[model samples]
Every structure is written in C-alpha cells, then in structure tokens.
Target: MNPTEWRTYLVTQESRSAGRETAAVVEAALSGGVDAVQLREKGRPARERYELGRRLRDLTADAGVPLIVNDRIDLAAAVDADGVHLGQSDLPAEIARGRLGDEAIVGVSASTVPEARAAAEAGADYLGVGAVYRTGTKDVPDETNGVGPERVAAIADAVDLPVVGIGGIDAGNAGAVTAAGAAGVAVVSAVTAAADPRAAAAELREVVGDGR
Candidate 1:
C-alpha cells in the first residue's frame, strides 16, 4: 500500500473474542476497500497477542493490504507485519524508526498542533488523530480530544502527513468525518460487533468511498 490512500480502515480488537474474530473482520474490511489494517489488541497476554498478530499479518498479506501492529515493535517484527502504529504513550517515533528502519511504515497518534508537528519532525510516516467522538478506549483521553469534524480538520491542517480519524466513526456519520479532512477512519466495534461483518464493512466503504 502507498500509505496515502484516502480511506484507511483500522481494526482494533477490544473484547474476549477479538483475537478469534479479528481475521474474518479484517478480511471483510479489505474486501470492502480498506487499504491498511492495524492489529491493536491491548491488555492481552503476550502469548495470545503474538498468535493474534501472526494471524492478522497472514490475512492482510493474502489480501494485499499492509498490516501494522499497534504499540508493539517486537510483535511487529516477530510476525513480519508491514509496520507499527504508536500512540503518544507508546514508543517515540524516532526510536520506532530506528528500530523498524526506513523501509517500514510508522504512524504516531497526535492530538495537538505541537504534537503533530513534533511527530512529523521526528519522522512519522502518518498521524492517527482522535477519539474524535469519545471512544470506548482511552482512559485519560487527550485534552483536545473530541469527535468534532472541525477539530479533526484543525489537526489535519496543522500537519502534512496523511491523517486517519478514530473514535466512534460509522455509517450514520462518516460523511462528516471525511469532510473534516481525514484520509481514513479507524474503527473497532462498528464492524466487529455487527451481525454481518461483511455488510458492515461494505456500508462503511460506501460512507468513505472505498479509500478513493
């Protein structure tokens, strides 16, 4: 993937069955037009996470979409994932760069103007911004966080890197998300929790225009 695709879909596993359901949901998302998939399963046992990473990497590879592991450089390397996506609380972009090298794609989450600029300067390939609408994740959320499209636009305007919008985005309101300047939208529960994962992914693709 070029990493500049207009609609990047992220799949983060949040519950007990996340590991088991991740592959199928990710495959459906790819079939529906997701450019990149990030395997973000936090707080799980290391052994479980490693196996999950392997499954995601294989599925993404077969689908021809890049798979990035969230917050774990070691697991990324272990599973031969395409890259790593890091949050502000995770490893620094420059250090991640050093660890992963220039060939891999590295993304950093940024909420404020300075943070976005710093991540760019530090060599991040892209930026993931939000909690745009209050997410089920993030305990002590970013201060500037909110799902307002305007706020997401503000962050996008502040940096040159490709931007991905996260936090509560879905079919009912994804239009405002893209209109706000997001290159893509990352979701967890929307597709995974749906009765039909493929249908959910297809609907989201319609909302975001299949990454254009």
Candidate 2:
C-alpha cells in the first residue's frame, strides 16, 4: 500500500497527556510507521489550529508522511498540508477540489454505502469510514453507531477508493480492521495516551504488520 493509503492515524492535541502536545505524538507515530496524520483540533480558533497545523506539516514532511488537516480547508491550504479530511457538514468534496486543486489529497467521512458511493463520485481521494469503535473525540457521531466488521466490509465493497477505518481503533484491534477490508486504521488515543508515545506507536504498527 502507498504510504498515504494505509494505517492512517490521526493525532488529536487533546488526546495527548496533560502536558503533551499533539505534535510530539505525531512525530512518534510517524517514526513508527504511521502512514498519514490528521490534525483534528476542535474548539480551537482558526489561528491556533493553523499554527498547530504548520508544526504538524513540518514534522510529517520530515518523516515523509502526508499531514492532513481535519475539517478546516482554509487552515489546511494556508499550512500547505498534503491534504484535508472533511466531515459531511464541511465543504463538499467537489467544492474542496475546486479550492485545493487536483494535487491535494481530499478525504471525506462517510458511514454508509450510499454516502461512500456519493463521496467517491464527488472526487474524494478516499473514505474515512468509522467510529469503528467508540471515541471521546467526536461529540456526535454521524451514525451514532460503531462501524463494526460487517459494516466495514460492506463499505469497502461499496467504495472504490482506499478506506481508512477511524475512531477508537487501537493496536488491539487494528488487524481486525484491516482484515475487514479497511486500507488502514485511524486512531486517536492509543498512541497519544501512552507514556512512551514512540514505543506505543511502534507496538501499534507492529500489530498491523507495519512495524518497520
């Protein structure tokens, strides 16, 4: 799988330890085979998120992994990140394409077959399909239900693009996610919550057969 096409781990600032920043966890995750990173900071003002995005961009670029901004196209464009991952309420994929142009990788979150199909048709580079498990990050999940193995498999069958199973995925179940047809697993807490973020990332990637 392309680096950006697998094991898509998202690093949320809030998921970090009391004093740790998201950047620290992201750097560690990238070093341990995290193919892509998304900066998903809610409640933070645009400037702060943009600033944070810049640091994350620099960090991921150094590791040769794409950094994606979550839900903030303007901040993403400003930081010149590799891409943006948007929710359904955010700008539609078509409009985002018009704004970011062809080179930028654009992903959309979709919970069902019909949504996934429409997102692909709209030129999304991939689908972020989940809440494969519960997550503290999202206040209101679009489906309010987890994307279990059956749902994952069905969505994978419905969509042609790479699918990253997100929300609450951890090393313990990452293999199951991949087996369910997800191109990768996107996690938030597992790595960041660990005392040794790098080791946590290493262990997690190992579970997904990506230890290197």
Candidate 3:
C-alpha cells in the first residue's frame, strides 16, 4: 500500500475488543474497506504478541491490506509485517528504517508540527497525529489534551507525509478531520467495540471517503 492509501485506517484489538476475536474483527474491517490495520497489543508477553501478529499477518496478507505492528520492530520483522507504528517514546524512525529496510512502512506518532517534521525527516512514511477527541482506548499524555481538527490541519500543513488523525474518532466526526487536511483517521474502539464491526468499519469508510 502507498502513503495516500493510509486513509480509513484501523488500529486493532484492545481489551474492549468485544464479541469477536481480534482476527475476526480485523477480517471484518478489511472486508468493510479499512485500508490498513495496525496490530497494537500492548502489555502482552512478546511470545503472545508475536503469535497474534503471525495470525494477523496471514489474515491481512490474504485480504491485501497492510498490517502494521505497534512498537515491536522485532515482532514486525519476525512476521514480515508490512509496517510498524512507533510512538514518541519508541525507537527512532531512522533506526527503524535501517532495521526494517526500505520496503517496509514506518509510521510515527506525532502531536506537533516539529515532531511531525522530524519524523518525516527521519524517514517515516506516515504520521499518526492526535487524540483529536478525548478517548480512552489508549492512554494519552495530558499535555496532548485532544489537539482537535485545527492541530491536525497544522500538522498536515507542516508535514509532507500522510497524516492520520487518531483518538475518539467515529463516523460522526471523521469528516472534520479529513476536511482539516488529514489523509485519514485511525480508529480503535469505534470499530472494535461496535455491535457489528464490519458495519461500523463500512460506515466510517463512507464518512472518511466523503470527507476526502
């Protein structure tokens, strides 16, 4: 997948991942038009995470959607995942690029223009920006305080890479982020916790596509 296609992203399978297994939710999301999937299993043992990544790798490969492993470059490399998403505190993008090589996608989380620019300069293929709204899916630093659409616009303006607005995003407000110049939105609970994961993903895809 190319940078432009990161739109309609899904960051997967949290504890709130209700009703179905993580793989099932991801399968349904891919079928529903999620362009990419990030396997973000924090707090699990490396072995457990690796096994899960392997399962997701097969599923995502079959669907032809990019699967990004969160944080663990080793796990990503082990599974030959399409990419890895790094946080501010994680490994530097340049180093990740070195380890993952040129073909693998490297995305970094950024909350400011400077951070976004640095990530881009460091060889990041895309940027995940926000806490666009207050969200409990992941613990965000209090300083971020939900940067909102304007910050997303600013970061989009500052960075040459694709910017995906994450945190508390759903079909209702996804358009605002897209209109603010984000190439896409990264969602967690909005899809994972939904009664119908496929339907939820489809709705979000519609909303984001309309925004673009």
Please give, for residues 41-80, the per-residue lDDT of candidate 3 as tens digits.
7887889888888999998899888989999899999998
Error of 2 at 84 (Å): 0.6
Candidate 1 per-residue lDDT over residues 128-184, each given as its tens digit = 877778776555365645747787788889888888888877887777888888888
How accurate locally is residue 32 in candidate 3, as Cα lDDT from 0 to 100?
A: 90
Q: Which is better, 1 or 3, measured by lDDT? A: 3
Which pairs clash inside model 3? none
State TM-scores per candidate: 0.91, 0.92, 0.98
* Lowest lDDT 10-residue stretch of candidate 2: 1-10
Which candidate's lDDT is highest?
3
The regions of model 2 sitting more than 4 angstroms off are 1-4, 210-212
Could you tell me the lDDT of residue 45 within candidate 2? 86
Candidate 2, 119: how far from true, in Å? 0.3
**Candidate 3 C-alpha error for residue 162, in Å:** 0.6
Which of the predicted structures, 2 or 3, would earn the higher lDDT when compared with the native?
A: 3
